[model samples]
Target chain A: MLRTYVDMNLVSGKQPHAWDLGEFYLIDRIRALVPDIDLTDDCAQIELPYEGTLLFTTDAAIRGVHFPEDSKYIADGGFRALAGAVSDINASAGKPLAALLALVIPPELTLSEFDRFLSGLLEYSRHSEVPLVGGNISRGDRFGATISVIGSSNKVVTRSGARPDDLVVLSGSIGGSEIGRMIISGEASDADIKSLDSEIIGTLLYRHLRPLPPLGLGEKLAAIGATSMVDISDGLIADVEHIAEASGVNIHIELGKLPLYPGVTEIAQRHRIEPAILAAESGEEFELIATMSLKDAEELEKLQMPMTVIGRVRSGNGFVDVTLNGEPIPPGFSEGWKHF
Target chain B: MLRTYVDMNLVSGKQPHAWDLGEFYLIDRIRALVPDIDLTDDCAQIELPYEGTLLFTTDAAIRGVHFPEDSKYIADGGFRALAGAVSDINASAGKPLAALLALVIPPELTLSEFDRFLSGLLEYSRHSEVPLVGGNISRGDRFGATISVIGSSNKVVTRSGARPDDLVVLSGSIGGSEIGRMIISGEASDADIKSLDSEIIGTLLYRHLRPLPPLGLGEKLAAIGATSMVDISDGLIADVEHIAEASGVNIHIELGKLPLYPGVTEIAQRHRIEPAILAAESGEEFELIATMSLKDAEELEKLQMPMTVIGRVRSGNGFVDVTLNGEPIPPGFSEGWKHF
Candidate 1:
């Protein structure tokens, strides 16, 4: 049932702990699904190839399957659980570079509680300069963290580059990491948090415990052309049906042009849950869902962090409709979060 | 009680699972400790300042701490517990290259019993082309195996370059891996099977389950002119008291010029133990202990895997002595295998 992409304009960026807005809309949807790498910054320029291109990816976070045991700072929850496996190689725009990490703990841990979970993953990799390079400390019988990153993308954003009428966009906002996991799972009630909106529930519990993606906007949406991309860590109708089954095409959306944030429709009417199924199955909400050309979304709405269109693409293959007023609404019954 | 270096030597020439042994004897043992850069074999000739070099080391093996928990490829017990942490960058003659693997397992395992422990570590890293690259699967809540390797050294072998009267050498043989973990723990019996010498009990159970070090022979003893270097991975009197406390001095040795092997004194007289404390603390011996200049061990004993001498150096400070018959002896009760 994977379908996310609840779209609040895919994280609006302005640097929360380091530029948020759902990590600049999943680096503008992995710079339009990697247009020959260079995810934009913080060192990444590989050349070696006798057997190069082996940058694999794997990220598991379980324990209530993704945070909240006593929540927050188990070393930025092991630096956002190894920054969601180096944000799937920075959402394929690539270059989050080197990682293996593999932790598991839980057997009533201690070695100084795994050194405060490696002091919050070495101060979130020394404030994200990212260099714990390789890892694997164990005990596990389950507490989970699993990482795998190995970046180096001189150019490679793949999800099958979108086409047809294109223009889907996003990059931020969706359901405040599903109303910050319903206020860390009490299922929100302090009188439904006095009819909420506290600066959009403190930016949806700071996008569910510090998300901040959009680093170097995936080489500026593959240097301004972007046709297709992914990374909405399952939401927005399960990451646009994985960009409609990796670009074969057909997407649609428009549930009254979705972009909600003010108390996610009264916390989806006090937990009956359907503010687009807590923004379509709430995953980590990394954001980014590209597919350009509405004249490059009017020149990416004159950059400075654009992308917000929300839906189009055609010629059929996957989720061919979502509508709302015109009918079809069977599109918001939880469409993400799966592990096993 | 930490001492182990399961009697050294793996010998064999240049690259075929690569092995050079030189960085001129690890820049005569760590060029006065740290910073010199550019070391090559070409392939972007070195120069990696900080975006890399996180390399770490951890080794552990215990059943009797380093082997024999039942054999016949009990998955070369996780490929000699990751070739004893890639024999500490092949005892600083360097090259281990990459690794992150962290297995703890033991809940009486099964998943086809750890797929023959990843098929004896992907057949010894596909016969040593080095590449387990990423890892961290867990369960261990401990039968034995700790491995932690993370290599890349063109010039990093440190034990403090032995000066004084130099020439200590060794790179091979020493109470054959405690006579192959006493014939895989039956403490030697197989009753006179084949009236003794089965080619020195099959080269002491193939150097106690493949201890093989020699890889990139520390960049060919740091491109010749060897000086200092370690890698006997504990023992040889605690790795010559860690190169006589990092080359402050003393050393000596002799004990009828060590070496031993061929049915190591009939497997230390059927396991009564002492063959010099099972050649000083028997552990998975990867070998190495360098230090040269007797005109670079008579010009690296005219090439093709040479080295041997067996001891010297003087000026004193870290005391290591040894001799036998011609005198000394004392420094007995050796110590090596110490975790915690």
Candidate 2:
């Protein structure tokens, strides 16, 4: 049946256009799921209508950019990429409404793999409870995924709301994703990996594979009048710089004050690598970094989730200061993952 | 600078994954474009509070499915595809607000060609008065363009509103696009093409290329008590059947009554093909197919723009009929374009 539908124009092997195979098949199946829609005539109708506040954000996962070519489970790669995009929206204190996923599948991928990728997307979508509303699927030269998520919130918390003397807070400890990715790349030995507790290592690998965004934390902080906030996508230090740049303030972090997972420090020590590298530059944390009144910070600490005051904001130029023992910590050449 | 950033990633060589591309680089560039985005928090902040009705629609344009591979101006092809998508929303008598275009660029396409493609998209977007709000970019195996458009409509005309005995109408002549496609495919001779009026030919080609959707026709018909309506994306006969199916009634189309462009008949005759194939099977009309009261049809006929009583609906199962010289016209094997 699939062979019958594959256009002869493509199968005749005139070097099928990029959209001929996997993505095309995916689109055909997906479009069938959508009911009739007519935009030219004013009479066209949709199955449902949009309601509530609309929060929108776009994220791109590019080949040789966000993931490795031979990496495990391309389907999982797509899932994690989209989840990260949605996490940005959730971090903004918004309730996810729907997502518009634009996928770019490479020619090397098979139709079955593409279908499985879509199945994975649907799986994540179902798990997240954010319906796939409407999006475009196009062909690209390489495997790529761009996700635009739309959500809603009653009162939004912004990165700019942080003020001087506000207490900085982080939702979770970092460094698991970086370590897990290293293990996936086979750079780290099994003995090196097994030295850590199996469950902790498994948790680290899972976190690296999929970092769950603190969904309700942003809204809860917003409701309690948290000043400013941001997601730690480009490590804690780098993302804080983003807020500082946008809000025109300086963020000073105490390295000793930083939080770490159970095995991160030991792994860093064993490798003779700076724990700061794992703690600071490692990406895909998906944790909310917020600035709040010291009193509000104390109140939030009473919650079940972990909250740490790793830094403070001060009136100055947009600079990020990492201090240990009241002295400046030199920054690295690569400041997290800068897409630009 | 690009080379240096590329070196920062752990993944190197042909097997480099998306992560090797240096996350910081992409984030920085994408961030420059979206300076106002609050990424430090969960969920993005909306510029405006939610108000009024929100319209949404998605469309796909594939290489062999929608356009020929060796066509002139692939960039225009992109523009035309977007126009077609937006036209569906306009058909709802809605003003186009914004569009999130998800593009899949084939691997073989150069960066320059990609830039030209973006220019074409921007051109169409600027002319249509719809900002390219946000979308995803990815690499794919083939050339496919999919776009999701958002618009606003004061009133909506649904396809299920047609009453029995309402007169069927079309916004423009049928079958021009089929002729245009045939001409492009080298079926028409030079003399045959020359003998046709150039203006009509231009109109046909333009209709095939970029259809001027009758955006307000549905609302106007609805205002005057028009019943059910649909856009003629599929062939006239097939699309009306959709209306019949939606409305739970039978429709009878008067074959001899179809409005045709000036040069369509001669071309069809020269090609030794039935005009019905051109008239009934060819899609991309972007014209409003409507059912209205006889009084309303009369009033519409007196005014400018084409409107004809092509058929009438009867109380029955969702069956469609075509009549020529008072005889039933059998349905053709190829109803319209189907992806799968």
Candidate 3:
């Protein structure tokens, strides 16, 4: 069972120093292994009772800066740190209701690799049903987590409510996490995923070990009225220039309605680069750009919604543009993911 | 003005690398230096127009495991990581409202030590009026933060609501953070605080560089009904054995009603030890403790409060006891605070 509790909490050749198992015996072995985690005290009341607005967020991750500490998909770095903090509670449309994490961990990490990073953070907190209430763990030198999450709603979609002609859209396909981080930093080998086409190496290792965050298409574009939204985790022209500088407005885009991901132009022509600059600068791509109007983009195109439109908004000053068939695509090459 | 923005964000000897200042230019320089931080997107909605329950928590801290990075009181490690996450939102009496942080840091630290750790986390988020909203930052190796907070309420006390005879109390004094961590780990010197007594070196450097959490006496002992609480942070017999194992009962204590800290028995007899085992194991001593009802502890001692009672609860199986004048005080020495 659970591999004999990960071989009786291995860390064998004399490791033991998370204060030698003390923080209340590791919070009583995480309350006897997360027995439906109430965490019995020091905060986590939760209740919300009804009404709305909570959302929150946070994120982090770290290890060799966001994953790959000698890869073999290090439990997809705890499932991309709770899928990048529930992709910012699904780009603010909100729903997931709890999480906290913090972590740190690295006194030579082993209790079976921290129980496979808490089984990839309890398998994405049980596929986002959320609830791992409170957190904090410490010891450092590397490995990280942070997480946070929260969520709740009653129409919370922000990025400063886009306006001028609104449209944008997106929800899927972007450079498959820069070709699954060049095949987890081995600089793209496995004979370029056995010369590709195994459904493009299972869509670039499921967009880099499990990303899929359109959280029910951002709550169906915040109930078909999304005015602004973001979550492309740094790309698609730096998240449509953060919804055009938080809605001071401009955008444009339309580089032939770029959806791109099917093997990102054969892995950006085997790394020579430009598949429209890895579809507008490769980054995590949790995918859900948004903005709405033309009557909620004609009622999300009468609900067919896998999504794409790719740009519009107006009234200037906030920049972004691009084009292509209509001509003007010149911006000194790709760039995006820089997370200081 | 803010020392010329900390000498123009100095990390001078060409230190750069927080991905060369880009997570959208450090979130547009933390939205132009925390302009009342609403952080325009990717979660942080907040609102909560009424009802109750929230609370939450989190904590972390790290850097050399909670403080002392060449201590010039390292900006009270960002004010004890937001007063240890608002002392678990004032031991759950709740009220604080918001916070988030996460942080991490360490690319050769300076920017005037990250703006004096954001001016000790905006001076304890403006003395707990809370607000910092959302957070994250990243880059790792050393510095840390985590924080979290939240809070709210309408009666949410918990530690599993003590019962039997209740009483217990506490609120103030305990070992002054193990003599301000043996005078910040130089193993206690300044002639041991000039042979002590300048109000015991200002109550051991204000219980180790600013602790102060009894958030309004844990909201007046949770509006005078507190059936259980806990803050002491790994001390007073490991936080009254976590409210007697979350109220399955037992407690007792009474070893001469400990309220230590005023020089903790002359620094536990100048470190030879036993001043009632540094008043029952030294740890952080954030205070609080709780459990109540002897008619709300005689209406909180006719509303004077600073508190003490120091023991009671009952039933059993959860352990703790101690005594002294009534005899039985043998528990194989003091113990507590060994965080790892």
Candidate 4:
């Protein structure tokens, strides 16, 4: 009998209205879902046995801007939101301890949709071993969530530690998420998504929906003597520019050595756009870009980490220079992503 | 000069567009405003000195719900948002160290409005000595802020430790914020607000605009052997019910003993409503509600901590009972504030 109500409320789309259920009922439901959460208190308490530094980061995903409201990817939206927040912890070389989620929901959204979102969030939390310790829900005109991740680290990495003679490393490939977003946002037709090989479609959709940041790899990089690091949240050039400005050094990228996804060139050609533009300008990649010494980079390479050195730091005013085919590239090659 | 550009951009309302200035440009402005914040990293790191527990809490303030979009109370909304978040730390007998803010802004909001909101947030951070370590800004239909407070304590107090014979104490008065909201939301007329005395208006507005939570009081209560504690963000009855349910004890409140705001009676009379209902149903009180032994309660009273004993815990199934003039109160007396 209880299972019937649960299924009706969470799967059949025949659930009581949120206004009728009230806030406490929703909180009770969440508590039942995440039983480890301490919902009886005003604040969640976490004990730290050893002395360490606490790392904090917050990220938000809006309905229209970050995800489509009308699409069937609501669960994917939740996964992406939490993953984006956890990616910051990964970038900092810290072990995530817990997370706090604040969700703003529109009245038009149904309980089943909310349940799917929570399922996605819980799935990530269970996989990452970071419990959802605290949260708040409020009414809003559109659905959105702000996820704050709390982490701890013995040795913290910052974006201002790179030196002049460091090699810049790119973790894995970029531009895949942008391609996936385009497909999900209907910029690409259903036939376009279907005509693509299943592996490519699956890979692109997975990358776009649940872009997993390689956790623990950041700590390994830190141990291997990475000087500075940043996540590719706002595209390669833009994010690297942050490291350059913060470290007060110039970065020269060997464009010919840039890493690209397998089908990026074909997709860009089909879309009548340059592959370099997609590689440089696509955002939400969630890949780490770090700077290290040549010896450290060689050691990391030997360890078989999925990263490639694509640039070198120089002593100059903070600016990024690009070279292609052993020649200085002209200005306006790839402006990178701009968010406002 | 930079000052001219700032004034023109912020005050003259003829500023460069947000899209033109870009997200990074706004972040730079915020960094300049709060110079102590470390903005050059993906995560801000805080060192934990010794063995202790970390307290985490998050709260959100939506534009239409928490404050009117057309009203000039945007700054007050910001102040209330941070204060409400900090109140959770106070409830747990914790000292806040830092906060992370995530703001969603509409495109129509001016640069000056955003500046004022930040000013309000910074003012609270400065006064509380809790730094704004990190935050994220994104676009949305209406302005809203989610504030996550990180705190620490040697001994934490929760809401589940009250004994059967414990006494319930309230730190301060209630119902002023609700009255102020009525006025601000235009449910009450300008004449209704004006007919009230200046002192009453000032007190109500102050309580409404910037609800102050007694932070050190919770710690002091914990040190003096408080069994359980909670902050009255919801309402007196609603919040006390939380302690009762968590502690697995019944709470009986003496209606005549409630600490009501000075103008509560007058405002209730003017509105043709019962003062008890106002005291019981108002939200955002931000006052500490604690449970302790009679001896500790007496000691606290002797210290003149602006608290009064309103109820006592009894061994029973978790429930709240109300009494008036030594008579048992009936059901549906005070339904309390409902958030939906």
Candidate 5:
């Protein structure tokens, strides 16, 4: 019987490329028991209509790079990684079907510690209904996780489809997420973030730590005829440039008209930062910026997520211009955060 | 224009979750020019036929873990990773459609070195006709890539489908791959592996380094009604257990009948190792093992790749007993490699 094989203590020969026995499928099976998930963009939609277009995209979170190195934040790292991947699908107006995670666990991480991180992923999968189908694991010197999501849809909203005269709309506020990250890292202490307002500080921290993408908004925007769409992973300029370049159109975002998280201005003021620039330059918001016709924008603004009109598309070749308040920004204005 | 933003020298306030500017999308765009790929298992096949089954699987190669730590092996790591992924699709008798990569690059690696690794993946994608559609990148202290491949097929051969009286088959020789690994690591010096015929060493090294799983053989076996199939990643006993456990039957391999790689016994002789055990426990040999009716096996034996009937399925509860010649294997028989 195979039971003998498991109990034998005889030395097995060299195991060059294999992990120790029994560890191979255990993590995946444990996660499968927890739940399933999804994360995606298009191989095709317009060109291969009704063939069931598949949307593909990948996102990553690295300890000491994407987040702090504290093991306590491991689960948050898992949640953040999944949110970033699924938001791409939301941008495409597609439902996430499955997510594959690649995790590099440093030697110091106990199996229990790693399971804590996996819990974050499992919780999100159950919530999003995007099952964690399977992933690969490797031992390394640092902790890193990368997730690839595949989705299916009858239609897709693409970055390349924005046109001149389209209105830019944001699904929610910005600047909160970046500030939230600061609070979590202890960089914004009671001298600033906590002193101003605990509720506000707590909200920002929560947004940064355990954010979920707006569940079903992209489809609504797509249904109402959005010309282009992008999830706000990076700051305004960094991510929107993808749409601007791909669409071959100029974009002009008005800083004054930007929708901002409530306490963002106070935080910017305390730090001697320009509030408008902070809002435009913030990253990790995971909200959405979409372009559509004025009528469609009007319909969108009335939706429950508090969508706001922020900019307009213009005819140009792959560039975006901005106005602070019907005037060009100061020459030495702080540049936006470039979240690649 | 956004050009003004890229040229400014002002310091960024903070970048908690973003990579430095201008590095975004460049790698994906470059690899997109090269090609795309795929890698899979069942979300469904038999349960949901006529409505395209999506097969999913992930494989990873980490520096110092799956392979040696030399930077020269980077490209081969890429190739091996992709091959390991696509081979899963082959086992399901499915066509691979697209592949997604999640890469963690060490901080010291230069862009050119990284591009060399990318070229390895791109080359295989072109050869296999599996497009490298999209992937994520992050900087860390260790290099790793996990690939997730999705495939489509109307019919799939599952591991749970084997039954009593089914004959087990090996698609090609084994044990050679482990030896090949030894030669590459320089562990098997001229006093050992190099003492063999140079052609045999070259063939084995080639087999270990750039193994492309017998591409079309799996589908052919499925077409001939192969009852169960699995790609030989780990050695014979470890992987066969998966089928036995899944199918609720016993498997038995006859050591005398195994199609040994040329020179395996010669090399095993030098090390005072059992040749039969060496053949049984070698890992990372991506050849396949399949079970089918004896009549179907007879028809499959005529294929071009030289399939060999080495074992048989018996009525038992997931235990694989083996015999060397007509005698049972020795009680202290060497155990198989435990590749996770």
Candidate 6:
């Protein structure tokens, strides 16, 4: 039987002799990474969300761009891309329900490596509870995966809802992702991350590969009535500008009040750069910047979420101003990720 | 004032001066092609499908892979890719509700070219009735797009439902897409497409760029209770094998009865290949293949759809047999598309 034929090739990391790209052949590849995928009927079918509204978002991760394409870390690319996609739903305070993945599998990659990539993707899909209900795979020159996530929330939030004087909140510390990357790439180490406790190093690497989105926190955000919110994938300085522009308001971040991730200051020292600047420019942190009333902010704090008031919204014409102890920091804002 | 800043560079094919990748900046680019997108709140919000079950599918068109990336017909790539994506929904006898596009823009492309690309994508998106509700764009070495379509249907059909003795029907003719590619790439000519009537050539080329799915025909197929269905994307011969394997039965095709598009016979003759083989090997036709009971198929024939019974299902284990006027064809079944 074909099942016996394919099982022989899987363990040795060799392709099935005379393997062909057919619909049935792919089911076996997907099953190896995710054993519990409900074989979708042509495409994935899900019950319509009746309790709330649909919130759909998509993101892509490319080899050699979004992540280190080192063969050893190729699997991380899959996990990271899936993680970044789900962040958009949480940014809008929506709970993710399902995801459809489209994989561009390069002929050059060994079947073994591609399996790892799928595992990396499956790891986060399971953890985030966004089941990979269906997907498509095709041969291409390079490896990439585009993840489309469908989610829903009764209380929808947008970047255009900020009001003047709303307390700007940061969901968690920044720069952890960047430090994780540096350690992985072997770039820094005076207070080198690898030299630290194995536990700390593992934590940093895990965060880099799969930064967990603050799950279930979206409900609290909506319950407390977040005025405006955006995730920190584009860095703090750049994303605040998004809020300011969309809401037609000005935002001033107290640079000193910005919390740095645990190893960020140490890594910044090793890299010999201003830790605050590093925090301000780090992208893909997957944290959140939300603006809300001070009373609501206090209530959220009691929930023990790792959130801090890093800035304040002001009435003005779409300008983001960062300050250190009430003094404007500088002239040029640190560059964020530019997609074009 | 901010609107004026971005609009000044729109027509002249120049990047917006001091252009920064922000959520607001993307809104302007998207608005250029689709003038009426109700700017989404964090993500596109669509009402849950209340009438039927949801069918979600995704596909990717990579540069120089799915279509030619020549600058002149770059726009066609967009239209073609979007068209191919919607094929899956129709295959399942479902109605497309919405689509999400993820664009990978290359810096080497001009602003005018990018605008043209968006227009191309929007053109077919409009034609297919699958609105572009939301998408993401990122910088990459080559241009690409990943499209995910969400559809719905009251009666669902899959490839696994074929029963022995069922009549196999094809929605439209094959080999048109292959001919279009030949014309566009200037590969073949004779009783050539170019020498033909401008309108006929135009129609053929249009079919190549945007092969219309037999829209709403799925509703009719479901009405008469189609047992198994798939779109003729991977060529008829290969797709027939899909139905056979999925349904655990055999499919026998009468090659003499295989319908050929208007110019397919001429183009295949010009290329010095048998017309039937070319038709069997052709991909991206976007026609539907369905198997139904003999009585239901007779009812479907009276509905005036461009469907013809070209084959039948038999009791067996996943073997596809092709016959020429009740005689075995040749030494090798013509090679269909092998994505890997």
| Residue A44 accuracy (lDDT) in model 2 | 27
Best candidate per TM-score, number?
4
lDDT of 5 by residue, A130-193 (tens): 7676666666677777777777655677888889999988887888877777667666666886
**lDDT, candidate 6, residue B39?**
50
- The true-versus-predicted C-alpha distance at residue A165 of model 6, in Å, is 2.4
TM-score of 2: 0.76
Interface RMSD of each: 13.5, 5.7, 7.3, 1.0, 10.5, 1.8
Output the number of the DockQ-best candidate: 4
lDDT (tens digit, per residue) of candidate 6 on B1-340: 6666557666555675322344456567787668555454447777866677778888888767777767777788788778787878888888888888887766566655666777888888888778888887776666788988888888888888999999999887888777777787677664466556677677778777767878878767978989988887778888888889889999899988989888778778877888878888788888888999998987886679788889999999888899877898762476665331
**In candidate 4, what are the lDDT values of residues B192-240, reduced to their tens digit?**
7767898888788878888888878878888888999999877888888
For the predicted complex of model 2, DockQ is: 0.27
Give the alpha-carbon lDDT of every model: 0.57, 0.67, 0.75, 0.82, 0.71, 0.79
User: Candidate 3 chain A — worst ten consecutive residues by lDDT sum?
Assistant: A11-20
lDDT of 3: 0.75
> Which residue pairs collide, candidate 6?
none
- Residue A266 Cα positional deviation in candidate 2, in Å, after optimal superposition: 4.9
**Candidate 5, TM-score of its B chain:** 0.85
lDDT of 6 by residue, A1-340 (tens): 6667567777666675322444456667686567655443456777776778788888889887787778788788888888898989998889988888887766566656777788888888878888888887766656788999888889888888999989999887888777777787777653576556777777777777778878777667878989888888878888888889889999989989988887778778777887888888878888888999887887886778888899899999799888877788884667885321
lDDT of model 3 at residue B283?
A: 73
Q: Report the C-alpha lDDT of model 1 over B192-221, residue by residue, as the tens digit.
A: 334576776777777877667777776587
Error of 2 at B40 (Å): 11
In candidate 3 the C-alpha lDDT for residue A219 amounts to 73
Q: What DockQ does candidate 5 score?
A: 0.25
> Which residue ranges in model 5 land beyond 4 Å of their true spot?
A1-25, A28-51, A330-340, B1-22, B25-51, B330-340
Runs in model 4 lying further than 4 Å from the true structure: A1-20, A189-195, A332-335, A338-340, B1-20, B190-195, B338-340
Q: Candidate 5 lDDT, tens digit per residue, B1-340? A: 3233433423343211212323453354354555332111001011112245676666777767776577677777778888888888888777777777777766556544566677787778888988776666667777777787777655677777889999999888888878777777776778887568888988887677677888777778888888988887767777787788778899888888888888788888888887877888887787889999988887884677878888999988888787888678753354545332
Better of 3 and 6 by lDDT: 6
Q: Rank the candidates by TM-score, best first.
A: 4, 6, 5, 2, 3, 1
In angstroms, how far off is A238's CA in candidate 4? 0.6
